[model samples]
Target: MLSKRVVSCFDVRDGKLVKSVKFVNTKEIGEVVGRARQYYEDGLDELVMYDITASSDHRDIMLETVEAVASEIFIPFSVGGGIRSVEDATDLRWAGAEKINVNTAAVDRPELISEISHAVGAQSTILSIDVLRVPGGPLPSGFEIVTHGGRTHTGIDAIEWAREGERRGAGEIVVNSIDADGTCDGYDVELTRTVVDAVGIPVIASGGAGKPEHLYDVLTEGGADAALVASMVHYGEYTVSELKQYLHERGVKVRMHY
Candidate 1:
């Protein structure tokens, strides 16, 4: 099995790190650059910085903020929000982002995924799918792909979209659960497993990571390559080193903290 990776997420809005429930009622936490620098120094494997409201507001990601955070962190970083075309992806790479994550834009034009992947190697593109479950069993409350920062539903089956994304050349897929986001209960394991089974690419599970044990559960039981965490890490509730230590002790393969 591949070693589980610890990825820290910074949900930026108006150039600040903000935490909110289900993408609403956001409260500012701190500056994005400072927190990103701290995590990079603390041995995080990678960083995911997102302008949470950019797609909803129909604006480009704050390149100035991206450049500032990029200069401070040495690890691989992925930036997303309002990334609509091959040019957008190329500009983000030029601005120092290692990968470009596309959500709303991809949903609006599925072909863009393939176009960006072809323009800038598939490895440089990430398909970020925000999902919500509708209560219905026989269907397993199956995934619904959401866009525009969870404000709009694309009416596409999440699993099918993930499969198509892989076929379209997306190097990776980020499955973010809208219902479980910021709840701190745990990841929606079933939701992750379903997507993982549907696609052959790396699936990074996001949202609802509350504790070290939760991380463990998702990596092992949930079968995810990596997990993206925000609230737990941003609020000082858990440290990257501590979580890695616990995972290592549990016999889960992870980069050991020095």
Candidate 2:
């Protein structure tokens, strides 16, 4: 059986780790490298870092920060934001990222997905989709894709976009709910299930992971391959070991050690 992964997300702004509620009211968490090493030591399955402002500001990813974090973690480390070309992805890979995530740039040029996958192989390419619930719209899934740190709402249907991403050589997709982000309520299981059913690739459900039960719900009922966690792990609410032990006792398959 495939293990359900618990991924820790670092939303970095100005090279410092930060957190936000619905992508607003951002506040610094601390120096990123130390926090990353701490999480790695805590037995996290994987780690993802995002230059939250890179795309909106139209700048390249912070390679220094990426390298810094990558040096400390032994597991898969994925980085995204402001990756506009194949060269950028290559640079990140060289800097130690095991996976390259493409968001706004992929939306702008869908072929960039193919290009990166072709260059690095699909297994190393991840499509990160930020989705918002748009009720009463022409969208079939009632979810719309948002970009540039949830600052721009692209009217594209979430399900169709996920399908397109898979067809274009994206090996994995991270479905993050803009509405559920930082709310600590739960994941948008409906949104996650919609994409999971629409594509053949593995889907990582992101946003709104409050407690262990929420993770269980998304991984089992929602049919997600993994659950991305932030606030719950970030604010001393739970450690990676504690969360894994909770899920393991409840029959959710997860790696139990660092």
Candidate 3:
């Protein structure tokens, strides 16, 4: 098996790193650059910074904040939110973002995925889907896509969206369960596995990662290429190195050399 990744996520609002429960009740945690540097120093494999209010508020992503955090972390850094065009994605790349994540805009116009892949390499385009479980919904997977930081329901079947994203040339997919986000109970392994099986590309499981066991479950049972962590690390519940060590000792392949 390939080495599994432990990614630290920064949900930034007004240039401050904040976290929320189920995409609500957001609380500011700390500065983005400082926390990012700390995580990188703690052996984080990658970092994802989302301007959480950018798309919802209809504003551009905070480039200055992105640049600040990007300058401090040597690991791969991904920036998302308010990306609507190739120029926006290219601008983020110029601002030192290693990858560009898109959600609201991509759902509104699926062709943007191809447009971005053509302008930038497919490897740099990440399709981030925020999903909510609806048991009796009009979808086979019983899951639907939510956009604008989990404010609007798109009625797009989560499983089908994953397949379509792969077809449109997204190199990776981030399946963030809105219901599981910030709860820290555990990752929605079932939701993640559904998407992973539907897509041939790499899948990253996000939301509800509370401890090393949660990460392990998602990486193994969920068949995810990586796990995105927030609350567990943000609140000092665990460090990136600690989580990696836990996984490594359990026979899960993870990067030991930071």
Candidate 4:
């Protein structure tokens, strides 16, 4: 197995960093550029930035802000939200985003995933899924896709969508749990495992990251290639290096030489 990744997430709204629980009640936490640079200097393996309200507000992504933040970091990071076409993905890439993450747009038009992936190699295209468990659903796994920033449930089985994403050329999948967002309890292991099992590409387990133990659990038992953390680092509770060191001590392979 490859070394597990410690990915930091920055949920941005109006060019500021924000955090929310269960995808609601969001509040600004910091400036996007400063925080991105801090995490990069602290040696985070990767970063994921979402323009949290772009889709819900029916607006384009914050390109200038994306460029400013991108200029501050050197590692691979994804820019998401309101990306509706290959043109948008190209713009994001030009703005310095290493990858493009599609959630609501990809759901509304599944073909967008392949279109962007075809335009800019599959490795640069990612499918970001906001998912939740719906009891008595068609999926035996019980996880369904939620869009519009988790406001609308699509009833689409997450497992199946992840499989389809891989077939359509998505190089990676980030499975974010609505039940766990900002809860900081832990990632939804079952939800992550289901997608990991169904997809051939890397699966990043997002949401509900409380501490290093949580990262370890998701990367090992949850079968995720990486764990996306926010609150634990955003609130000054821990630094990226400290978390990676903790994971390393616990026998989880992490890129620790930096």
Which stretches in model 3 have alpha-carbon errors above 4 Å?
54-61
* Model 2 spans > 4 angstroms off: 53-61
Tens digits of lDDT, candidate 3, 105-177: 9999999999998888889999999999999867898999988557888889989998898899999999999
lDDT of 4 by residue, 41-98 (tens): 8888999988776454423447878789777777898988778899989988998888
Off by over 4 Å in 4: 53-61
Clashes counted in candidate 1 amount to 0
Clashing pairs in 3: none
**Positional deviation of residue 54's Cα in model 2 after best superposition, in angstroms:** 5.2
RMSD of each: 2.3, 1.9, 2.0, 2.0
CA lDDT, every prediction?
A: 0.85, 0.89, 0.88, 0.87
Q: What's the CA error at residue 203 for candidate 1, in Å?
A: 0.8
State model 3's lDDT. Answer: 0.88
**Clash totals for all candidate models:** 0, 0, 0, 0
Angstrom error of the Cα, residue 140, model 3: value is 1.7
Cα error, residue 195 of model 4, in Å, equals 1.2
